[model samples]
Target: MLGTHRHLRGLVGGVAVVAAVAAGAAAHASAAPAPAANGAAAPAATTQKVLFDDTKAETAGNADWIISTSIPDPTKQNASPSKETDWTGALSAWGVALQKTGDYTLDTLGSGNTITYGTGGALDLKNFNTFVLDEPNNQLSAAEKTAVMQFVQNGGGLFLISDHKGSDRDNDGWDSPQVIQDLMSNNGVDNNDPFGVSDDDLDISSGTPTAINDSSDPVLNGSFGKVTSSEIDSGTTWTLHPSDNANAKGLLYTSGSSGNTGVFFATSTYGSGRVAFWGDSSPVDDGTGESGNTLYNGWNTDSNAALALNATAWLGGGSSGGGTGGTTAGSTTGTTSGTTSGTTSGTTSGTTGGTGGCTSGQLLTNPGFESGTSGWTATSGIINTATKEPAHTGSYKAWLDGYGKATTDTASQSVSIPSGCTTANASFWLHVDTAETSTSTAYDTLKVQVLNSSGTVLGTLATFSNLSHNTGYAQHTYSLAAYAGQTVTLKFTGVEDAQDQTSFVVDDTAVNVS
Candidate 1:
């Protein structure tokens, strides 16, 4: 029952090869030239290729890499099946992201590609700068192993990702493949058990699941912040061999807990190539219940996607030319596709003050909102208060304003947003003094508008009535789709009659895009 996944069938190997070559050519023709090197034409960059030995073809688009999997047929050794469809879907999504960032060209292994044992089935390493090994249960043949080693030694990148355990050999027992063992040894990794620290085993279970921060490494810098720990169902366990090789660096490690176990290892400079080995493949899986949510999924944001992209970029000689000579995969070019769009996910909150504020509970540092400061303003002839007005019983304070006027002389404050927040949204809370009565006959209103960096009104997101006379706080929400991805401002345009002056307070301001 081992290696029992379904395989792809009716795969016209020759036709697939033709289609792949044509696609690559078309993409290449459209691509801009690689950045120049020392005023001369740069060396031709290597292609980003991926090998899929699993069952799903739909997931082929996930990587900027070309897809090459065994044809479909249960009886065939590398046939496509539904069981591996989930992994395929995940990889496909990743590929799409990678392609958009100018990292690599994605393709599939045509049916014509030989599925031989060992290096025989090993693709011509010359064509690819990196290979993503995602075999579900099938082990690499001896020839495949030799080809992989040669490919690595000759400056290729190999990202070997193992599932919860190695492969489910009989739907009951799990077994590690020799290909994985060889990979570990080649990269100076030890494959010993959970408790061993010697060169025999790279036991990840010995480490703890902890967060990493403040590093210059491209993989971490682009993450924007720290990586959160999630539950791993079948993560592999490993410990690196004690070596002084300057090229070797540990990218991520686990803080082994009862629920979260295993270490994530990354190595560079294997032969002339780079390799990243992981104990868990779930982070990048695209199957059902695996698309979103960092708790269960592999990569959760653009930062997460950068990890794989950086590896490919480095292996492809895409690193900056001064030393390596190519752009990081994060800079790859292509449009993004899939269910989620924009900034992925965001939380909401509120705040009030003369200066425009962010939505409550939202991080306000990105668009340049001063930390711990209200992002709002009040109009002239108005009693504006910038003191500690508690939103709830909490100790945090918010800005308050009493008595407003319609004249241009009224006091006013606003929150200025940095460029790139054009397509954002804002939410916050407002409280009006219910007892205040204005004798003036003019209409009073509370307004929120999205404006360009030059103060041009792009669109109105929200406007509230009777807010100047409210007894307590009310939550308000608005979307900035009209001004997304641009440098814009969130304005609280309030108007009051000349004779009527009322007090208002605001709290918890959040700005974000889902």
Candidate 2:
């Protein structure tokens, strides 16, 4: 359920208190935080990219998603595209906010991209850091699912905006709810462990949904302040399973059928990436639209605009120096270049026995390579001490060949297995930057192998090649239950062909035994 609040106007605990104050009142209530008093430091802005999805046949490819307009709307319908009517699109206000405060560039994926991967015409997931899929009425193909999953697993942000179960805009066989379910369930994705949550089976047709007062969450408070109210015309909800994923959080909730609770907004983590799911798309619409089409003054009607902006900022790498507005870290509202800083936590520095050298569940020492590769054996390549590319977790990661090199590299770390432990799991983050072809004959590959204490290869855990096409760091998990009772070594072998180059990076090596 959505957690408690301090002084929300329309929500109390888990129940809706009242219809959001009139549109004008909401605007006055949810205004951006005032500028710093007495010339104090202002919140800085984050520069990021957001890609709206249009490949799913949304509104006949018009998508109705764009940034806000600078001009006023006309009395009559203006169907043709023009700068004056940019407000007619659903995401106009959101895009405008990103441009003004967050320094974010927003664009839509055209029909040509096609959402598929590895078919020679597949959309390149590396081009954008965040992907927004709203009101998808088409079923996702296997390739599309794999592409999206891999994209998110590799530190990409995904915003899933769905609608009511049967609110199929197009008369196609698929709907937003069903397609989202397919994406999160094993039945369609063909994996034992899915994304770990699915939408709740409830459609609220009457009252609106109250934003849960979650002050601690960055998404609720980040650029927009607190999210108090959202217009939910007719929307569904989500159900979070903490057993499957420990990071799932319910951001919006309401009374469900039979006096139970329902969650309409939820956030979770898939591998090293972040995900947010909103139940409805109407909250993004701006009143302008063609005649005979349903419209909503959602951006100004409630805290909808602020909610969208906050969600976007959170999805784009959480807080940037914990700053806001367009101010650089040490500069005034307009200047740039003041140095962006981040902290690294939980590094292994000599301790042993648990995951990442922790006292209990930690297992690997110097797993992040922050201590200059003290715990691992390397061949042909070395730890990348320079902070060129961001590490998946800590401050350091092993670079197989420093990109653009045609050479083989190997890195290995040994772990002691507890005799009483019945389950063991090995996981790490890997980044692949390659110039090789992603076809059947791809030669630059990263192979994960398990070796017994006697220097004998037990098995090959997995092989990642250019066919998967991950341009960012993605978490790879392999079960080490087969070596539970014996000490073994996990080795990452990067093989590069003589022609093209591939850089294989490994970081945050961890083994959980219990």
The top-ranked prediction according to TM-score is 2
Residue-level lDDT of model 2, residues 1-514, one tens digit each, is: 1111111112111111011111111221211222243222123333455667766766543335433322222112222334334444556556555545535545566644567422322234444456789878787776677667655543456899888777666777777888888776632222423344687645677446676654545666665666776767777877766434435667766544211237667776554346888888878877665445566667776677767777766565521111223211111111112112342334334334444433336578777776655778886335654444446655566776434446678889888867655446677766655555433333666767778788776655555554434434445565565466688888888776655556666777777665
lDDT (tens digit, per residue) of candidate 1 on 1-514: 1111112111111111111222333323322124342222233343344444442112222221112232331113222233333223445445545444443444444333533211222244434545566533434444445445544433345666654443443342323433465444432211111011112123233222433442434444432232333323455644443221223345565553221223454444432245665555555554322333222344653234455554444445421111133332211111111111122122234333222332333434322112223333433212222332224212222333233444322212334342333224455555544222322111444445555666665544433323223333444444443333356666565554543433334444566433
Question: Estimated TM-score per prediction?
Answer: 0.40, 0.55
Q: Itemize residue pairs with steric clashes in candidate 2.
A: 43-324, 44-324, 66-92, 67-92, 68-92, 354-362, 354-363, 355-361, 355-362, 355-363
lDDT of each: 0.37, 0.56
Give the poorly placed runs of model 1, Cα more than 4 Å off: 1-88, 110-123, 169-178, 185-208, 222-231, 244-246, 256-262, 288-296, 301-303, 318-514
Instruction: Report the alpha-carbon TM-score of model 2 versus the true structure.
Output: 0.55
Candidate 1 structure, TM-score to reference: 0.40
In model 2, which runs have C-alpha deviations exceeding 4 angstroms? Answer: 1-46, 60-87, 116-123, 186-190, 256-261, 318-514
